[model samples]
Target chain A: MKRNPIGVLLALIAALALLASACGSDDGADSADEVDSGDTAESTSAESSASAGPLRVGIVAPSASNDLAFTQSIVDAVNAVAGDRELDIAVTDGTFIVEDAAAAIRGYAADGVDLVIAHGSQYGGPLQEIAPDFPDTAFAWGTAVDTFGLPNVAAYTVRADQGGYVNGTLAAQLSESGVLGVVGPIEVGDAKLYVDGFVAGAKAQDPNVTVNVNYIESFSDVALASEAATAHIQNGADVLTGTAQMVVGATGVAGPAGALWFGTQSNQTPLGPDFVVASQVYHWEVVLSEMMAEIDAGTFGGEVYTLTLENGGLVIEFNDGAGADSSVIDGAQATIDGIIDGSITTSDG
Target chain B: MWSDFFTTSVIVATLASAVRFATPFLLAALGEAVGQRSGVLNLGVEGVMLCGAFTAYYVRLNPSGWGWAGGMATAILAALAVGLCMGLLYAWMTLVMHAEQGISGIGIFLFGLGATDLLFQKQVGVPLPISGLRPIRIPLLGDIPHVGDILFNHNVLVYLAYVLVPVITLMVNRTTFGLNIRAVGETPEAADTLGVNVNLIRLGAILIGNALAALAGAALVMNTNIFQQNLTAGQGFIAVALVYFGAWRPGGVMAGALLFGLVSSTVLQLKTLGIVSGAASALTAMAPALLTIVVLVIVSRRIGQPSALTRPFDRNA
Candidate 1:
């Protein structure tokens, strides 16, 4: 049969279109190559100096590396530790879906990265399964403490409640309305811990103060967070705080309303420089450095690292832009000292 | 706990939030209703929304010293243009190439999601705040006690949504274009025989629908005053579902959106007031989606979907 030239041309064009669409879908991973290239540059420098290359670190996070929340906290820690060093770092971000995260984690392990960080609580179960497969690869997962009793798996979690307590104490002192609002993400993992501590700290400061907490049941729904913040303000909450990436929405509301806002996960001063009084900055490096040291010492896993105020893992970073009074700063410092010295317990009332 | 929830302040707050939250959904769903009514089902609304959101956010961030109002206008227009372009692509794939509507839409969605996130990482790097649209109170109506706070005080986009509902309803029910759309949706062959340009009408409907969906994205970012990855957060899908729940009518879609928005706001209010404990908050958070499903099931039998919905047209065939 004679094939029509026009028909063949159309077929070729259609095939190309199909291929283009398929390539477009894969473009998400291509964006990550920029991060990978940075790692390559560092590893190349390290390889020239030593028979063994730099300590390779791979991270799989649920949100963007710059989300200014849970994921960014660790990403910042990794970058800080990698600064002026030969440590290699690679990250696959926006892996909110568990299956996608699992694939990335497994890929990293297959590539023989020295340490793989599974950076979400949702990843605990998958790490439990994958860690055993890569027994030689050091695996660190958190906001959780389950190591699956595996020798190569290490778990790290933030004592976010400690910083939450400090924030709550300062909020209570600064709040003229004597009403504080907290917009939490899902009531699980570190988010719930932070809210519980904030409420406790507020009550500790003023028993008569009304502290309202709202869990939006989503870690990434900024719109819901904004609505929650607005609702809190309407109900006479002069001070607001929240955890996770979505808190940007809440902080946006609070900043414009001239309400005080406390933040967590990472420094939220960038979100609302004028309103953000202080943030419970998660210096994961405080724990990460220790974990890496332990890994270097042949303690590959079976240990859980906890970030605490006493250990300086969770730092209360005051936003200098917010114009917090000296007395307020002094009071916050006193509370931090109290928590560290075991004098003021952060237990939920 | 329940007493806290029943307070007038809580009710007023929830109602006000409901109106604000419903704006995006109503706009997007109404747009989708128009497209579905014209026989094309574009599941790429979510992707289109993401694109619109990023475009609006980028415009808002740079502003080029356009000032607040000018920047906001520029952002909305930019978002609309992106949405219209996306609509054209979807129309070409489904109308000309006869690609599977669902798969093509999924492709568009993935492209939107990836492309937006990539651009955000490269351009913005960090989520930044913008001077978003602020609320405007309607003169005497805004002073009418509870009703004023609930209905008459909202951002300009919310008011636009309120106005679009009636305008869209009229356009769909009482105009020549409306008649042609309905005819093409029901029977493209008959409409074609009657001298209606079936493909052109369908293409126009797709463009209009997607453009509005993109505007919905803009409304969302403007209302929130900030943008982040996946900022729409499945609101686009909910908007699509809302069309079915609304029985593909503007008024019905608005009702569906209001119901969802109110339920969601109330759930957060209840959680805030401690009427719903943390252990049960997850379940309460599901209330809006659950209610949507239950309502959809109840109304499934009464409302008929467009016959040509999701099916591509071929003149020769």
Candidate 2:
């Protein structure tokens, strides 16, 4: 018998394909069983107020939960909320592709979890499609305002501009070059809003200061982001800021250039300890707690929640290790106060 | 938009940016050109690049405190080693095992993507910054008006790419080894009859191509000074396509890369200058890829790919 290598290769490929499909289905079935057990536990624990079973929260995000950017901000907030309560968290992260995210979202809903968070603006279309199907299971999503007017859906967004304003204020005050660079992911949602506020705040500080904004038009193109930052630095931007996971690339450039960096979504101090001046940390718990309360009170959805500076959902965390002057911190606090008191508007003029 | 983009300062800046952007593409495409010229189409260049980028990032992150230049050299060497290893695996699967080149390449790609992401998550839990190689300006040349800033002022890798383009052109077209590569790629059986070891030459070509592809990845990460999951994006695939776009010639590939780099940098500059409105970003973002397709279609008529580009060679046949 002659050994046919091609035949063996074909068989190996087929076997691997089958194995992949099997593993995918296995994950689906495992989640279904977990949901089934969760439903049973929920019903049993409903009667016991003195000892509540863990409140299961499922999250589907666009990137890793520890990305130190957009997704991590919410994950950190959720963890903080869970610290004082009995909670079980299930996360399906790195779902940048909408189809994968949709499957994960539906899987979590089928699991009969108390709350399912779809944590990306891109997930809105899929959530709108999936939310009505799960009327009993509360669904929350955003960086968007449209709840699709669905009864079982809640929409939450951050006034990221508020924090962006504070960051820009400090960035302007600390800039010796009087030029700031903004490396934005895409010109939409929170990223765009943050850039607009940042530019506005920078101009408000000193009308003559130049603020260069570059939207690399990608959420995960780290290389492009770095190039954009390099271009910015070459063009004389002494201070920089960016939003999304790709900002890691921008910060990488800025840090080495000794340029002050303002970050959004999560604390980016770890990425650039000596260069990261501050971060606009998103504290989603301010809104998440409210959504959880509403769900517990028998309201399935149909409300929009916004994270604002006044509500303490967005906080400007200054990096003390970055050698930021107290004057800059004071100015940042003043800007925050102004925004909260409606004395300063983050809106572009 | 044209008015702003046409300024002297903007033109020089855009050119400089283009050179920086084109380095990785040029390196990878030139590598793929060599491999394709030798009758192999390793679509796994993208995967190989990802592995290289990760290796380089990891090396830079956990440096031997070998100073900046020393650390960069170490990272580049490690990336090349990884690329060579991947090339060997690809060669074995496609050449020895007689696996389908397309599927095997895809398999390599998937393996690289998943393995790199997993290892990165496990070892480096979060993205960290490294002091990447900075641009080194050639004193006299860098001082030469606009030309100096655009062409002479770049990182060492970019300069290497500048030299590699012409050197590879010479190696591929004007050398005896080049003739053997063309002969094996065109007619392996005839080459074998002439006493050339087809398999040995193919293996060598694959290894060299992969090493270059790995260097492309290293250059990308080092240029950026940071690494993230899927950091190469689809640049590797673009690099592969560029070989065809370049007509398998080093010069043509460099030209294609520069075109892409310039277009991309211009779009970014336009977007930054607020000359291109936000509403037009989606269209502008597609500009580089769309232009590549148009160029490829135009060039396809006159230039032909290597005859046996993806055909597996089996001595038994």
Candidate 3:
């Protein structure tokens, strides 16, 4: 009976090992991809400063970083900055619950991690609430609007509209129906601007073309996005675009169903090879690398930094760069170059 | 007012909302059915559901790019394993150690919630954007006029929930294992004396029940196409109340679920129509739980649960 108990314990441990093995593939793939990013990794190390004891930092997000289209860019930027430094960078999943975010922030703060990059806008409120208690710690949230002015805090934002305008032009030119769809995230001020730019750009390309818009009221709900996309599909909209964090759900529906899609934030072409015509890509690596350089130089301070088209903060990723077809890239780049050179205007004004 | 409320969009929205609301409840209620039938009242359904949803989302999105099927299969499998382990642990605590079932179940719920959130923090490192399960419209039935469009045009889990209702009903009525489960709940000592292994049966039921609860979590995340922290909210507890309204029968549980789904859909549609104020809309969202409470109070006279629920059985007795 005692031997049986030992056997049962071993079986339980074995089962758990099998379960962990099953779970590791996704994470392991991330590491493998990092290895493939050899040049980028080397560049990161070369950039690290010797003066700073490779600042140990932790980042928390409200969701997992798998949507290569938007969230992955931010993650890549952070990881690049960390890998270059001799820093112990810890990243905890925020999972988007208020309580969980609070707990994770407090845990990291307790561990004396020099900086906690609360990346999601949702994390701003929680970090603000927790920040006062942990006075020694510094926080750098992603969105500008959420960061309250404090000695220990900084916020960074990008002019997403700059890229949105260029992609909107591509959507207009490529659409067979001359009707484009813009799926915004919850009607927030920033999302509204992105949608507004897309609409203005589409109409700028062809005054006769109509742009229909919908907002899902949250950044991460892909199912609702799909539902909204379905309605637009039913309404004869041929080119779909969204400002939400997860465009895959909308693009996933639009791609197989024969409607072309323009994506936002990160590169999303892999989600639907044929359907994802192009995306307004946000490269987090450059921004993080720039920021970390300042931080290592001992000149970093609490302030808001907003990047725009002029600084190469945002770029229109033609399907070509994403291993997409040549015909698509050439046509899209015509609009993209026009926007860059000041020949095309995507604004309503 | 009428145009906004009765438009084709509103009708489609309402049907979509019903499917969205029905999925988690159906999954949790099915789990509760198994737990209750084994004389163990597991109230930890909510915790198990949350953990499953979080873990499932993480499994789906890790970049080695497990395709859609692989992603979904991982979630289901992860949920099942977690459910099984939690169930076994709960059984050992409540059944073997003879702890209070209600308290132990609540502990399990709390543990599941915190543990899952922590594990997610360590593993996922950011919020995961798992693709929601796509709706697979059935062949001819999916093309059928009005009903087919409304009912069949939903993700796979919603259909699975619908099928489980009758399947479970039939299982409870027809199968020998089901008979033993029912017998164990009613009078464990008598069943034990009659040569049934009450411990084994109860443990089996708990594991099965937890699995169903995990399924509820998976269904919500997969069908909704996203996993939010505290995603299940109070759906698990509502599922427990539904068991009473359902009189512990699968048919009754499904009817109760349908009513809850309908009420939720109506409220959401009302919000979209702008008929309800923002404050009122918030209140309207609570309609399902309030209705569940009202149903329990009204239906208590007609329904009686097993006499020995929550009491651990001893063969020596």
Candidate that scores best on TM-score: 1
lDDT of 1 at A104: 88
Instruction: Score residue B66 of candidate 2 by CA lDDT.
Output: 53
* lDDT for predicted candidate 1 compared with the true structure: 0.86
Candidate number of the best lDDT: 1
Model 1: per-residue lDDT, tens digit, A88-181?
7777778888998998899999998989999999998788889889888999999888888899999999888898898988899889999999
lDDT of 3 by residue, B27-73 (tens): 78987987798799998888788777776776776625656546667
List where candidate 1 sits over 4 angstroms from the true fold: A1-48, B65-70
| Tens-digit per-residue lDDT, A155-236, candidate 3 | 8787676677777777777788887777666554446657777877777778998776765455665545655565566556
lDDT by residue for model 2 (A1-349), tens: 9989777875775565445333322243333243334444354345434655667788888876668999888777776766545556776777888998999989889888888899999999999899888889999998789889899988999898888888888888899999899999888999988998898888988888999888888999998898888778877789999999989988888988889999999999999888898999999999988888888789978999998899999988888888989877876777888899999999852
- Give the 10-residue window scoring lowest on summed lDDT in candidate 2 chain B: B64-73
Worst 10 residues of 1 chain B by lDDT: B62-71
In model 1, what are the clashing residue pairs, if there are any?
Answer: none
Clashes of 3: 11
Give me the displacement of residue B267 in model 1, in angstroms: 0.8
Q: Give the TM-score of candidate 3.
A: 0.72
Q: lDDT score, residue A28, model 2?
A: 34
Rank the models by lDDT, top first.
1, 2, 3
